[model samples]
Every structure is written in structure tokens, then in C-alpha cells.
Target: MGAPESLSLLNPARHAGGVFVNGEWQRPRGGSRVVTEPATGLELAASAVANAEDMREAIAQAHAAQRAWAATNPRERAAVLLRAAEGLQAHFDELALAIARETGGILAKGQHEVREAIVICQIAAGLPLQAQGQVLPATPGRLSIARRVPHGVIGVISPFNFPLILGIRSVAPALALGNAVVLKPDTRTPVTGGAIMAEIFQRAGLPSGLLQMLPGDAEAGEALVTDSRVPMIAFTGSPAVGRRIGELAGRHLKKVSLELGGANNLVILDDADLDAAASAAAFGAWFHQGQICMASNRVLVHEKIADALKARLVAKAGYLPVGDGASGQVALGPMIDNKQLQRFNALVHETVAQGATLEAGGSHTGLCYQPTVLSGVKPGMRSFDDEPFGPLVNLVTFSTDDEAVALANNSQGGLSAAVISHDVGRALALGERLNAGMVHINDQTVNDECTNPFGGPGLGGNGSAVGGPADIDEYTRWQWLTVKAALPAFPF
Candidate 1:
């Protein structure tokens, strides 16, 4: 289904071109791509793809705008973010519908994403008021200070899943910290990811050129990463793509933050409540059809209770509704596209062929795949070793707590992990050793808060943090200032 008329800017004719740069929407130099609804295979909009030249212009415009923006007082910048948060809240329903229509997420999921984004906006609105520097001890008759400063222009490359949250989390904070942003959302969900932000900020009375939205493919993304004018880049996507961006940005000597892929695990200990653990696994593993980076790719259960938990997961998986989520009739929606569906199928089939038993759902009509479960999964299987962004959960049994930790930390990713146990102390202790960025005890892996530092090491992120005070380091640099009443006498 198409987006509501309130989101008409997604229409190519209304946008008048695909890119939003400098203060207005304009045509890009690159070719066009059709944005389709994965749930229905219907054309949602035709977005103008931005080529390298278009990206260059956007970066230059952002650089030009950033100087003046950074010169503004902290309160002024914070006020704009506060207003943007209100604007986002005002259009909550429309934004939620656009997310559902553009990304095939269920309406509830869309609403949740919008609400999270609004919270992020609200949190970011207060960033400017935070201490931006420190007083340094100096010699007598001298004053010294170190102040945080903006990085000028920041380039953000966001993925399709949870686009609004990912995009806003970076954009709002960057702008609040007095930096201009050039956002290149994944072309698949540009309306909800890019255009909506532009409309919200513009209505919130943001100055022109502070935020540029260019929805495009790899060529444009590379242009943003390699451009000399854009000194920092924030990317959220697959490990493969994040690596590419990291390498390129490193070569350019630019600061980059990456929130990449994960093979997150939900470890169910022997003493865990089977019903609660099973419900958590189902939601963590299959939410958003498992497209999320934090989605539980593997469910590791204690061998003592593996069979019981598996049965509950099988029963739950069998009953979850799967269909077009845009119709508001399903808990799980279609895969982002057929290409992703093919990949999910290949991984699941290969894992099953490797001797894992198909315990529950394992079929699909169109892009809506069943929430398949695999039992007897081993480390060598694709389902356990690879990051399959689909509705499939690999069930592996661990003999001891140490074995559970080893299995959970087996993957290259260190993004998120969850531990379920009746004993809170044991769960917390186990979680601390799991090598993940964020750990939830007695909860699922998929969790986020505006104030939480949201990133991991290794394949997950590149030593940079996001959210709350982390923005102070990610979006700005430091400048030292010293003054003396008179020139100190030197040997002459």
C-alpha cells in the first residue's frame, strides 16, 4: 500500500528531484531508483539516486552551514532540537504509517520506532547544555581552558531497518552539538528515514543547510566517506559495508563511528524460567522479521533444560502471525526484499542440511518467512556461524556456564547479548564476561535507550560510542586555550 497523502513529499514529482541539499529539495546528478514496499511488492515512491557529484555538493553546503551553526550559543542550538522533538511528536502517527509502508514493519513496530526516535530527539535537545570543556591547572598569572568544538560536517549512512531511530539518534545529537549533517539513508526506506527528517527539521525552524538528506547507493556513500570536507562519518549497517567504510575513512584520516552487524545471543541458563525465556527468545529472535542488528541470532540453552525450552519456542513460533505487516494483520512482516529472503533461505537450508533438525516453522509465502527454529545447532553450521538477518533462531545447547559463554562469544560480532536466569547475581556475572557492548539480565537482546552508550567493539563498532554524553566525543573535538597577562620574560 502507498503512504498516506500527508507523506506526499515521497512522491518523485512533489520532491522535484531526490536530494535535499542547501535549504531546498533538488534533483540529483545520478539516476533514479524505485522505492518499493517489500510486504506487497508495490511501488511506494521513485527516489532520485544521488551520485558522487551530488554528494560532494551536499558536503560542501554542510561545511558552509556548520561554521555559523557552531558559532550559535548552546541554548539556541538546543532550542532547535527541542522544537524538532515536538514536531516529531506532533506527526507521530503519520511518521509511524510511513515507516510501516516504507519498511514493511508492523504498525506497532513502526510506532515503537517513532517513539524511540522522539525520545532520542528529546535527549539530544539537552546535549548542548552539558559541559563542553574543562579548566586546566596553569602557572601563576595565566588562564588555561580546554573546550569541546564541533567537527563541522558529519556524514551519516543509516540502514533500512529501524531507519528512523538510527538516523535520528545521530542526526539530532550532531545538530544539537552545533555540527551540520549530510545524511544518506538507505534507498529502500528513504521516505521515513530521510524525507521525514528534512520535513521535521525544516518545520522546527532549523537553519538551512544544517542537515542534507541524500538517499542513494554505494557510490554516493563512498563519496561521503572519502570527501575531504566531511571530517567524520557515522555508519550503521552490515559488517561487510561497515568495514569498507572504515577502511576508506581510515585512509582519508577521518574519524568514523560504525554500528554494524551482530550475531547476538540469548543465553538461557539451567535455572531460568522456561516460559519467560522462550517468550523472550521468540521476540528477540524474530522481531522485525530478524532484520535488526540486535536480533538474537542464536538461542543458547543449558543442556539440562534445552528440550523443554525448545518445545516452548516451537509452540510459540508456530503461532506467530506472518504476512503483510502494512495491513496491520501480522506480528512479523516481509523481509526487506526478495534478495534478503534468498539469503535467509540459503542460510537456513544450509544449516538444516548440516544436520540441525527443523523443529518448527521453516516456510514462506512471498517475502513473509515463517519464524523457523533449528535444534541441535552446532558451531560449524551457517545458522550459528553466520549473521542471518531473517526470522530464524538457532537452538544450541550448552553443558556449562563456561560453554555458554564460549558459544555466545564465538562470533566476530560483540554487539548485544542477553542472559536469562532466576538468579540475578549469576546472570549479571555471566553477562559481564560475554564480550558484548550491552547486556540485559532477565530480558532480551534488543534494547536501546537514548542515554545508553550504544556500540560494541570488533565487527560491531570502531571504538566510538553513540548516545547521551558519548555524542560529546563523536560529534566534536577539543581546542585548548591559554592566556597570559603579559609575555613572560625569557632569556634574551
Candidate 2:
């Protein structure tokens, strides 16, 4: 297909009027907020900043809509999601362009994200039937079955990176399971998220208020989560924010799923292919400017291959084309905003001050930070301990499998890890010992499959996304149903 026509930039106030609530497009009572493109600092769109009243109204609508939707059979709900997926695919190009422009992701990457969103929607559509529970043996003349049920109104707060895909992935599963959703897209890239979801739901004939999109900042998100009407919350963002949300949800005794930040690690074994490993590491470290929650931030190479891997990894980083995300050939995009850029720069400088050598690409152009590699990195450096959340990777060398495994496990954040090794036995053994939620053998650890569970343990945070069946299961609660024959008249 040819490139999709770009969306005409609209004034933030005017765009904010499009926020969907109660089956109608309307503006927030508190007014609107402007969204700017990270790459050019151009105003991309404006979104309605929802207030306390808006949150209440949305919650009420969701509660009412969720009851009706939950009453609808799973088969019908599945059909709606399937239809939504089809609609998304039909308009992939349009959706992709909006995402690229709004989120500062390369056009190709945006297109891929759009496609992935469709896939997630399609997979989630099948969740209705797949959510079937088991029939357990019971007493004589009694039948007991455990079934999964939705958590009424669910609140979803998505991050700026992978806005389209992650939002859809979370929302689709919740909607498919017969729960109403209140989505708060990231303040920086709300246009693409709100637009794509509005388009798909409009086509799917979804009930009014079943899926509401409120695009704004932290205040808006706080309003949604703390509101008593919302029974469940799904958040993907920084750990600090996730912790706050968790604390709030805990007070209410509400259910919450959080996919927080990561300082993901990658181990390069002595037997690995230096060229391929370097290339994969570069991509894994720099994709989406390393804004991804699961982006590999630390590299542990066997001393035998450390020098060769570092040389090739640095060289590969230099080849990454960085520029306007709208440019099709650009592989690296700018950070989401100036704040993120500054934070990234600070981490790099701090790591260097701590004795880490800058291997390549530490310069910045506006929100764009060059794909950077730092060697001789030791523990205690900011980049080594904290998630850079930018295009930065720290490299260190290990002497043995035990030491490498120890180093990998040293981080409090155990989100995900990649081990590049030719020896399958050793890889498997290491995988078993590693404490991450997922491990990739001979590959970078950014692999996200719709059917596989995604999320990390410990400080990486607890919660999973898009693990096909696991996602469906996570969004629902189980109830046991027992049917028993009447007692004998004598007993009565």
C-alpha cells in the first residue's frame, strides 16, 4: 500500500474536544493540554485534561456499560474484538502515520507497531472462548465448575513509547473479557492512541462508554485510578508512578496490573558470534531510542570476547540513522521529550564520571541522543543500576559462567535478559538460573509474542502483558459454580 495521508495538525483545544466519553466526543470540563512532537518540538495535538468530575462521569458510564457487556455472551464479545481487529487492519496506514508523527517513532517502526496492535486485538478477540476454566470433581450428584469473570470497569494507563500497540493490547483483552475500559493515554502522544482506539471502537459498534479514551497528563491518570468507580487498573510506565498507583489501588482493595521500567541485561558468551551479537545488541539497545521498558541497558560479555564484541557493538551503534521520525530510513528516533533527553544525558555523564568509557554516540541534538555504548562499566554507576530509558548501553566483562550469572542476577530489576551462546546446554542452564521473567537464547531479549506472558520479577515489577492466554487469564477473576441435585425426602 502507498503511504497514508498525514493527519492535519489541529489546535490542542480543538483536538481535546474529541475525547470520547459516554459514546460521545466531548471536551474535558477543565480545558485541554497541548501535545508536542519530540523530534521537532512542533505542536502535534491537544487533549482534554480530565478533572475529578470527568473521571466520575467516565467511571459511572463504564460501570453501567460493563454490566451490559458482561451479560453479553463471550462469543458475541469475541466477535466484536475480531471485527475491531479487522477495522484496524483496514486502516493500518492511517493509524501508522499518526503514531509515527505523534510518538516520534520512525514510520517503519510505527507501521510495525500498528500491525502488532492489530495482531494483539485479533489474539485478544479469541480470548472469550480461550478463557474457559476447568470442571472439577465434586460430591455425588454435584457438578462444580470454575469460570473467569471480568473486573467491571478497568482503568488502563499507557506509556508514550509503543502507544498504539500497548494500549490496544491492554484494552482489547479487557474489553474481550467483558469489562468496560477507561484509557488514559500518555500526555506526550495521546493523539495517535485516542485516534486509533476511537476509530476501531467506532467501527466495532462497541456500546457507548464500554471503551472510553481520556487523553491527558498525570492529573488525569490520578483522577481515573483513585476514583472509586474503577475496580481494576492496568498501568505501564515508570516504577515510581507504578508504585504510587499500586499504593492507591491497594488502599481501595482494587486489582492492578503494572508493567514498570527495566534495566534489562544481556550476556555475551565466549562462543557467541561477535558480529551477529553486536548487531542484535545495538538494535536491542537503541530501538525506539531505548525508551522501551524492556530495552537491554547492560551488557555482560565474557572476557574472551569482550574486546571484539565491544568493537563491533560500538561500530554498529555508529551506523544507526537518527533524524526526524517521519523520515522512513531513520532507525533511531528522538526521546519522548526534553525532560527524558536531559535525564538520559545525565545518566551517561554520571556513568562516565564513575569510570565507564564512552565507546561511541553520546552526543545529543535536541531530544535526539546518539545511540551510545559505554565499556568498562562497573556496578554502582547510574546507568548500571538504574534504567537509562534512552539510547544507552553499559558494557562489562565476566570471567566464568557462575560470575556472569551472578552479575546478571545482581540487579534488583529482573525484567528480562538475553544470553548469546552457541552451547544450548549452557544457555538453558543459565536460563534456569537467571531470575528474569523471560530470557532469549542467542538473541536480544525484546521478543514480545502475543501468546507469551511478558513482565519481570522483583523490582522489574509484577504483572504480565500479551502472553496470549496469560493476558486473558490475568484480566479476569475466577468463580466456582456448583450444581447439586435435591436431597432425598427422608433427609429433608
Provide TM-scores for the models: 0.97, 0.94
Residue 67 of model 2 has an lDDT of 89
Writing each residue's lDDT as its tens digit, candidate 1 over 24-116 gives: 988788967888888888888877689999999999889888999998988888888888877777777777888997888999998888888
Q: Give stretches of model 2 more than 4 Å off.
A: 2-17, 463-466, 485-492
Error of 2 at 249 (Å): 1.1
Tens-place lDDT digits, model 2, residues 210-234: 9888876767788888888888898
**Model 1 stretches with alpha carbons more than 4 Å out:** 1-12
**For candidate 2, what is the TM-score?**
0.94
List the pairs of residues colliding in candidate 2. 12-46, 451-467, 451-468, 452-467, 453-467
